[model samples]
Target chain A: MTMIVKKTTQLIAGLIFLYGIYVIIHGHLTPGGGFAGGVIIAGSFILLILAFGSDFLRLTREEAGSTLYENLAILIVVFLAVSGLLATGKIFFLNWIPKGTPGELVSAGILPLYNIFVGIEVAASVLTIFLALVIFKEELAE
Target chain B: METAICIIAGLMIIGALYAIHAKDLLSAVIACGIVGYGLVICFLLLKAPDLAIVQIVVETITLIIMVAVVLDSSREEHFVKPDGKGYMSMAAAVVMTAVLLYFFILAVGMLDPFGSGSLRMASQYINGAVELTGSVNLVTGVVFDFRGYDTLGEATILVTAVLGVITILRLKGRK
Candidate 1:
């Protein structure tokens, strides 16, 4: 990869990730939600990997073990949702906490928590998908 | 109502037929991709982004897998499928798409004799999220909420796909 392509992809990926955060936060008011935003963020990270080199991404993902993160994400979501049910019986998965304030970053209840979880899951899963793909070809030519 | 679906369905079928009839199969794959995109538009109009996203992702994977298979096989003597499509099969495909589209439009359109759905159960979760959970993101609130089971199921599907592929292609060597 030339310096130009590397710089370009990194720039694009960074924009995508920032947009993802914007969407995740204002998700309540916008048509785009956590899932879509999360995907976009993951796409940004993927771009970063493509621009730089798989070596670093591999090191990062290897240390994390995407599968573990994916499983944990599922468990965390389930646990969080169930906790709401047990406490208030508020129709399972209900926020069950205080609305806090409305505009502040931490105003909403469970919104931020799930957003973070989704962010992690999306980052790991998208990388895992690509990692699995590269496995098809024993080695990536630089 | 039914007329528009018929036209859309007709165009889809024509694209597919042309795709198949074309000498090169790669063009046909692209044609199918276009058709898939059209179907996604229809799904969106019906107000189900979930279905639309799922269809697009699934088709993308399918296309990738197909391309991979073709690439692997192209190295060999040749690659092929059924000799040709019978006239009946073509007719059946068009008719089925049209019929299904008609029913779907009718179901989702303003013709649902009854007013908007009760949505009471849905409200319990959506409204509850903001009031109690303090969560600003509703999609997450619901997904991670009581309906978290379905999300887990989706994750399981991914795991299964990975495991299945790993098993099919042993670590010994590339197939």
Candidate 2:
């Protein structure tokens, strides 16, 4: 990668990641929810990696942590689902949290929570896929 | 809106054909990306901003990954001239495509015209949805609260796919 690419990525990647978080946080009021926001987040990381080169992340070691986060995020999502049943004892994925006023940041109750965790899971999973492929290619070259 | 979508669909078909016929692998991949982005335009025209956002980002990432692979491996695609057997296969493909197109037209004719679907199931979610789920976005409420099980299934499928990719690509299986 060139110095120009690296500098441009440094300037742009953070903004892209922040936009992804914004989309996830506003999922209740917005069109993009977990999946779209998460992918955007992953796209930022992928851009960073492509510009900086795989060696910047030390991907082989970081790969384990990425997988761990991916699994943990999904587990949290499932836990939230089951908690709906255990807490309310009414139904699975019940919106048990008290609904605040609609259109506000904190209004969506369990929906925003679901979006955040799902966003994390998706972001982690997608990054892991890219990292795996890049690392495999690196290893093959070696 | 219909005119815009129709134009985009035409462009998508052209892009698809070029992708299939292009000898340069990288150019073919980019042509495929044109089709994907054209669908994003169609999504926006249809008023599904959520789908459009997702499609555009996913399409970009897919393009990047494909370009990376093609650049590292090979730039040119090997093309073989069609023989008699190939011509036979091509004829079969043409017939199959015609039959599929006929069925597609039939299916499209049966569908409810755009913007006036019977909201038999969705009516419940639409009425008092903001109050019931406290999300102004009815789609989010339906997806995460009313139909959380389906979202869970979708997430699980993604996880399983990533798991499979990791398993296949990992440098070592056992320590």
The local distance difference test score of each candidate is 0.62, 0.90
lDDT (Cα, 0-100) at B67 in candidate 1: 58
Count of clashes, each model: 13, 0
Q: What is the lDDT of residue B13 in candidate 1?
A: 86
* Model 2, TM vs. native: 0.95
Q: TM-scores across all candidates? A: 0.64, 0.95
How much is the lDDT of residue A117 in candidate 2? 93
Candidate 2 lDDT by residue in tens digits, A9-128: 999999999999999999999899999999999999999989888782478777788789889999999999998889977788988888888888998788999999999999999999
Candidate 1 wrongly placed segments (more than 4 Å): A1-4, A49-64, A85-94, A101-108, A139-142, B1-26, B39-146, B163-175
In the range B34-78, model 2's lDDT, one tens digit per residue, is: 899999988888888988998998999999999999999989888
Per-residue alpha-carbon lDDT of model 1 for A61-120, expressed as tens digits? 462487587668756766776777887866666666666776566656665666566656
TM-score of 1: 0.64
Q: Tens-digit lDDT track for model 1 on B1-175?
A: 4455566677788878877676666666767776777777666766666556546655654565455555644433344553457667878899999999999988777553543555668778756766544545455556655566676566557556655654553344433
